[model samples]
Target chain A: MSHPNRLNINVENLAIGYKDRVICQNIDLKLASGELCAIVGVNGVGKSTLVRTLGNLQPKMNGEIQIAGENLGAFNMDQLAKILSVVLTEQPASKNLRVQELIALGRQPYTNWIGTLTQEDKRYIQTNLKAFLLEDLKQRKCHELSDGQLQRVLIARAAAQDTPVVLLDEPTTHLDLYHKVQILKMLQQLAHQSKKTIVFTTHEIDLAIQLCDKILILDGKTNPFGTPSDLIKQKHFEQLFPSDMVQFDSSSGSFKVKK
Target chain B: MGSQRSYSFVFAIIVLALLLAFLLNVSSGSVNIPFTAVLSGMFGGHMEVESWNYILWNYRMPKAFSSILVGGGLSLSGLLMQTLFRNPLAGPFVLGISSGASLGAALLLMGTSMITGFTVMPFLNDVSLVIAASLGSFLVLLVVLLVANRIKDTMALLIIGLMFGSITSAIVSVLAYFTTAENLQRFVFWSFGSVGNLSSRQVALMGAIVGLGVLLSIVSIKRLNAFLLGENYAQSLGISLKRSRLTIIIATGILAGGVTAFAGPIAFVGLAVPHLTRQIFDTMEHRILIPAVFLYGAILMLLCDVIAQLPNSANILPINAITSLVGAPVVIWLLVRKRKMLF
Candidate 1:
């Protein structure tokens, strides 16, 4: 859409945590526009926390996180909202909303005080509804949708916001394997076609390696960041977990269960 | 998601229901005032019976207006709280506004006599009672707001409000134990919660307060909708949590507190009206819920008032009892039929 390689996010030695306790540090990332990236790690390795910090949803404990050369903390919430949209995993349940209505909420940043959707705003919602294949379920209440459908509604809502960047926490946690690939592929399409910088935290390391343009592995130590093949070449995934339980297969770019 | 019918159509139905309920409420009182008399008396036409005209203007009109303001304000605040807390069970009184009013009324009716050992309070009247209740609710709301500022968690604030309720209720109980039987009986009667007994001036004041509260809520539609998804997402979507949350809490306080001040803690209507409105509208959008609840609450209050009046009889039931009796069953029936609560 815009110049594809323009850097959208830059994080250097970023430390993220709640209050004084730092959860993840020495985290480094530089995501250009039109990139789909994943942060994959062991449980409690602060994958979600780092994503939250990057989204500016919470305060960072240390280091610098900049979006397009501006400090993450420099922008007020309104400005930040225009720049980034989030689909949090722990997002409180709002099953009462209809699919169309939830998607329409993505246009809130540009709407009037009463949140009246403009023609352009309505256009964005329609585009997202179609793009995400949610047109058929647009009239259905979100409670009626399966987990895969609901995640689509939430991501479409973020895309409808038309922000430059989107951060999602575990977008495919509850979906089946096929749905997981479907969502990842849609996200890949969104990044390449719409030129939005997309980042998500996920436990799907295999999918992340296969589909994501880049992957950040938080091993509770190095927290390596690079191209998936580069990280694989660097042996970053080998030490990701207890080798006694699961072994990292570098050639195949996936982890295998130990027998 | 929107209702299949146009909002205009739904609004027309709501307006018709409101008018019918208002007329039914006005006509069926202790005295059997005919519908024709109500219409003539309200309009430019002359009433054949002079006393009927006086009753219409002086009593029924003021009482009916009180019902609308009290009902509408309380229900609107209930919707606000439900959205703010993101909890289905949350309502206007969850913040201790009503308990504060009860404490204020109790202190005036019985605590004064208990402390001074004087059997009479010469300055006591309906106006003073209202002032006392207003002061009490205002004080508790102030404390709650201050605490809310310091605490980031909403459930914690709810617990604090409940603690305030427990504290005020305990004080009221102590006053009840110490006061004489006459003072206690007066306190009990005041606690019954009437939409009558308010003078024209008092009703006007209540109307102004409810109007201001409604206007504040109307402008807050964006924040209300954001809050439906809970605070984190709301914050992400450009809502400054501290500022938005405070304004909503203050609006709810003015509404629930002002209504409780005038009407003495009317029950079940606040807790049930939003849920009922959702059943009909089948949407979470505040643009619709605010007006829908306002209309439904007014109509329900008017109907409950008519039943409480116990037409053509000297005896009257407490409005608090009538609201609970009518509201509780409908909610039960709705839940039973759906086999699920509207989340």
Candidate 2:
């Protein structure tokens, strides 16, 4: 496709990694506003790293990220929070905190010194609670909630943040298939309704292919990104699973075994 | 869903309970001042005008006010640390600040010929203790921060704090072993915690430190809330994890330090009050949680002080003894409940 218009993200020659170990380098990428993107890769191939870097969750090496033509570092915490929100995979250790209380944390950027939720902020929080089907569990403590409920609660928190970009890492992990589909559908609706850029990393390539507007593929080696169709056409998935037992079927755009 | 009215109703009840507790605190001392006398004294009148005035002005008033300040400070600090560290058990004492103050107090009591000699003012002997406590609290906080930068896990940080407390306790034990019996008795008395020992000026200074710390914590409520999501998530929300962490430690220092300096290491208020507030408020939003914690802590400390005066003659119990009598049962209950959850 032609270069997507309204691209708000620009990363140049980026290198990202964890402590003492570089995951990926020499990366150049751009993300358009309102685009729904899924990052797909084999295990340990740096898909999460790249998405984290783009989310400004991790520091970039030897390059810079520009969001809406402004450098990422130029935005202070509150300023950046107004633009981007992130949901991590780890559950918060705050067991006694309730669902609604956790969601209100998203409105932290908008609160004053004492962190009181404004009426409008409360309205937004309520909307997310209902949208996420968390109204019944509003008073339930986080530890009492199941993993699926916790995931939804966190997603609701990100929604309450009202940012233009929302990034999640493995939002579907620890979820059953039914809840997984529900979460993906919610994210899809979010991207369309809020016109927010939604970026997430997942291993469910078939589900991503069916749900995501675009898919960024990373093999164990070169070429860390591509659309689902493009990666299939390029045959990048052949080496991803490491075993010849599974084949990347082109017709149905799904994975199947040779058994 | 419960109506907003219910939330406000709960809040109103908490406020009323706090007021009642404050009144009881002002009236239920050894002198058995009447409610009317306490109220009138609060509004600039003295009932007896002899010992009532002396007792109200020189004794109970400052003691009660300091209790309120220290109670609020300790619990608020506990709430901040709990959120910042993302651990439910994190508190000022758990992080070694209280022990640090205890160590400082031990040093001051044992190191000198006279405890009052270190102060700038002769009349304000406890002034030296307050300064010494603040210094020690800050020193531990600095160490905790340095170690925190290296240690990433919340559980590990809690352990580090516990280890620090143990080390301080060991040092205090060694000092106690070397000191004279009279000095040791004084140190031991200070260790058991008391709310009535602070003079008027010392109370004022304690108020100033605690007020400053609590005000700082209030200002950082947004940051603290962000912290509940973990440090990385907080950082993404535009809060610097380092800055938020430091603010929490300093707030904790003032709370634990001031209390230990004057009250001599009050137990369980920091550990118990935050959890009590969380349950009472039914929400973890710091705006609600902080105030709830403050009120609950004030009530708890006051209740302990009241019980400490149970003898009513010359046999006032140590505040720590009363708190442990109350707090130990609650802790055991929590443990039992947690064990029941395992099934």
Candidate 3:
């Protein structure tokens, strides 16, 4: 396992935007190694877009991102892939691909042009497969799995990617209450054991406040960055949701609609 | 059977089928010849008639081998197109390669007749048509590739390809209208697609083109698999999408154009065989799928040739007609079963 003191990610004055429209701006943040961060916001906010930009999946509008003191663009694809991995929200309909095959794709950066898995690659895959409890479903197609199981499969894939930083878009979107907690716990466990920076976005803010070490809340007007306790202490959780329909009870630290 | 044994079993079946098709093709012809005589003649032993020996070696052997090459080539091209476009409906004909070849052949036949008349132009043979067809097919493929880059939608590219096909067909029709009766007869016959029409030289030519295309496809397996997740995903995996697509488009053009140039536009085999191969193998991996399609295509085409040689039937079935008969049903079955595109 890598040490928290060694792994570092820095985002300086980052502005994430789509074509002809700016989503978020002037975002400066740092993720130390072994941090389990949760990005939370109301619907239509730019949480997912921000995560995607920081992961280097999309181009940032105006600023620089660095991983371990090296500029993002300085590293080639394989070098960058070794540092950061992303689990996209879109569920692929590649039903013909088995669970093992799908996970093996995460090791594609390390494989040769023919896409053969090496012994080290096989070891990585095997470790993740057992970690996610996907051993029995190794031969099963992705389409055959439940949504909860599929989400775990995706996480296992990211683990097999063997990067220091993992960015997931809404990892618990399809899971039930039990699986959601399980996945969040698994992510926290991954961060602690592997010393990887695990960041994910979710609508489950109350649960996030308990599980996540840090919190990034994109309010579409003012983006706030800090741990959950820091945000709660700063008293910024109340203004996040819509003012009329939703009200944040400061004492309970949960949102409720006006009667 | 074990998985490894199952793979070998399939390979053996393909080999046995190839040999059977080869032998049956030699025996069943206009004049019946015994299998024993055909074998004996090939082995330098005494055979029944001199004419039979000549027909077996010169005519049937070339035609059968040519069909094998073209069938395997076109189906492999179809498999590549289906993967490239991510649309099951996409094949060689969808990209207007066939139409381009037809227009090229038409121009040579009708244009030559217009200037020199049929009597003086009698010396010009299938060689001119083959060259013209290959050039036209390559040109259309280049145009389609350029357009494909500008357009993001797969269906839009397919529609554009169909429009190209229509445009070339219209040009051939105009040539047909202007040409004299004798040249028109030659042009029409050329369009109907027969395995028997290929001479030894044309067979050699088709063999070279198909061989090159198949070899290129084999080397492209890694790139092609990346493409299965879509172009953006493929590009992220260190593949230059433009370069990979160019290789695929050129390979497809060679297969479709070379076959159309010599054998005419033999339809349906390209469109149907890839999907059938996928269903049988139950794997989308190109390493397995590409070769599976080639064998599946050869067997299907050979079966169609056998059906084309119906007994007591005054008129022999055109190769296209036989392909359509087998192809149309398979396509319809695919449509009903899958509902969406296979890829």
The most accurate candidate by TM-score is 1
lDDT (tens digit, per residue) of candidate 3 on B186-286: 87998898888577887888888788888889878877876765664454445667789988887887788778888888888898999888777766667
Report residue B17 deviation for candidate 2 (angstroms).
Answer: 3.2
**DockQ for all candidate structures vs. native:** 0.55, 0.48, 0.26
Point to the candidate with the largest DockQ: 1
lDDT tens digits, residue span B1-343, model 1: 2223357787899999999999888888887788897898889689888899889888999999999988888888888877776666557567777888888888988988877889656888656776787678767767876776578576788898799889988898898898999999988876789999888998998888788789889988998888777677888789888888768877777788778777888877877899889878878888988999999999889988999999999788999999889777876886788776545
Taken in order, the candidates have interface RMSDs of 2.2, 4.4, 4.5
> Which of 1 and 2 is ahead in DockQ?
1
Q: Residue A9 deviation, candidate 3, in Å? A: 3.1
Q: Which stretches of candidate 2 lie over 4 Å from their true place?
A: A1-4, B1-8, B29-49, B112-124, B145-159, B179-185, B338-343
Residue-wise lDDT of candidate 2 within B1-343, one digit each (tens)? 1124246777788779877877787777777677787789888875765788778778887878777887787888777766765666667777887888988887777755443434223332666787788778889878877787688676788788899889988988887777778778878888888888778888898888888887888877778777777777787777877777777777777777877888888776777677767556666666667777888888788777777877245578888888777866775676576652110
Please, what is the TM-score per model?
Answer: 0.93, 0.90, 0.87
DockQ of 3: 0.26
Count the clashes in each prediction: 0, 1, 0
Full candidate order by lDDT, most accurate first: 1, 3, 2
lDDT for B137 in candidate 3 is 81
The interface root mean square deviation of candidate 1 comes to 2.2
RMSD of each: 3.0, 3.7, 3.8
Model 1: lDDT of residue A197: 94
| Docking quality category of candidate 1 according to DockQ thresholds | medium
